[model samples]
Target: MMIKLLAIGKTDSTHLQELISEYEQRLKHYIKFELDIIPDIKNVKNLSEVQQKEKEGEAILKRLQPTDVLVLLDEHGKQHTSIEFSNYLQKKMNAGIKRMVIVIGGPYGFSEEIYQKAQGKLSLSKMTFSHQMVRLFIVEQIYRAFTILKNEPYHHQ
Candidate 1:
């Protein structure tokens, strides 16, 4: 199955971008992965938080295919350990899914519409993280999960 991480805005830090790229490259060896960035909404300062999320949601929804499994990286979602997450991914892969889309919303998070469309939600942590930081974190974890699945030396128990 193809795995796609869809996020809003450009990753501003050069260091973070480099790290994300490293993991992304490693992930390509195991599965089809794509990091799709939806540009930040313009004039967000002029709009309310709800409005901003609404606009961002529109952009996000447009990129999704009906058959794609939408998973939102949400604060209120279930948190899993590295091994558990690996199992979760394996289950999806074994299910014969075409594509799995995981999304990271803008500063305001996702809109009600976006939430309604999501098939599942996952949280990396209980503490808040900058969207830029979260991008690298998720990619690295994805790489780790693949390594664990392959019995590679990249992850430790």
Candidate 2:
């Protein structure tokens, strides 16, 4: 299965970008992985919170194919241990899932439409994180999950 991470806005911090790139390279050894950044909305300050999310949601939904399994990285979503996450990924591959699309929404979070379209939701932690930081966290966790699956020494229990 191909794993794709779609996040709103760019990672402006050079340090963070370097870290994300490191994991991106590591992920290639295990599976096809891509991180696509949806550029931030122009003149967002003028838009209402709901308006911004609606606009972002439209862009988010556009990136998805009907067959892709859409998972949102939501705070209120299910939390999984590292092993459980790896097993979840294994099951998707076992089921022949084509594209596993995980999205990290904008500041105001997802719209109703986006929520309706998602097949599942996952939470990295109960605490909130910057949208930019979440990109790095998700990528690293994905890499770690694959290493765990292969019994690699990268992940320590």
Among these predicted structures, which one has the highest TM-score?
1
Worst 10 residues of 1 by lDDT: 139-148
lDDT score of residue 16 within candidate 1: 93
Q: Write the per-residue lDDT of candidate 1 for residues 1-157, one digit (tens) a residue.
A: 9999999999989999999999999999999999999998999889999999999999999999999999999999999999899999999999999999999999889999999999999999999999999999899988889998999998898
TM-score of each model, in listed order: 0.98, 0.98
Runs off by more than 4 Å, candidate 1:
none
lDDT of 2 by residue, 76-144 (tens): 999999889999999999999999999999999999999999999999999988988999999998998
Report lDDT (CA) for all predictions: 0.95, 0.95
- Please estimate how well model 1 matches the true structure, expressed as its whole-model Cα lDDT: 0.95
